[model samples]
Target: MGLKWTDSLEIALDLIEEHPDVDPKQLHFPQLMQWVIALERFDDDPKHCGERILEAIQLCWMDEAD
Candidate 1:
């Protein structure tokens, strides 16, 4: 199944894979949201996203990064 807004960890993993050099902690929410939407397997309405969701994804990404 394609990824939804709730799939924060999966999305974080994918983001790291797709942009290995990026620092997840430094990403702005708008850019992060765009990148998430650009993920090949992502499948969700952009309207479903919010600051909290973005923060969750960022936290997951940071955890994976560390």
Candidate 2:
């Protein structure tokens, strides 16, 4: 019911596909992980429909070389 690492990757891939302007090189992994954690937390909160977490969430794009 929440976003795991795999889920986050899927979301990230979709976002990268949608936004041509997005640069994967500029992403920071630490910040991205924190956001993912927050997203999962929001999903578990019954009172919150996870709207706040959904607002402007960014996922990092990982290259195969890395």
Measured by lDDT, the strongest candidate is 1
Backbone collision tally, model 1: 0
Model 1 lDDT tens row, 11-65: 9999999999999878999999999999999999999999999999999999999
**Alpha carbon lDDT at 21, candidate 2:** 68
**TM-scores for the candidates:** 0.98, 0.36
The number of the candidate with the highest TM-score is: 1
Q: In candidate 2, how many clashes are counted? A: 0
Q: Could you tell me the TM-score of candidate 1?
A: 0.98
Give per-residue CA lDDT, model 2, range 1-66, as digits (tens): 554443445556555555546565564545544444454232333333243333334423444113
Lowest lDDT block of 10, candidate 2? 40-49
Task: Please identify model 1 stretches exceeding 4 Å from their true place.
Answer: none
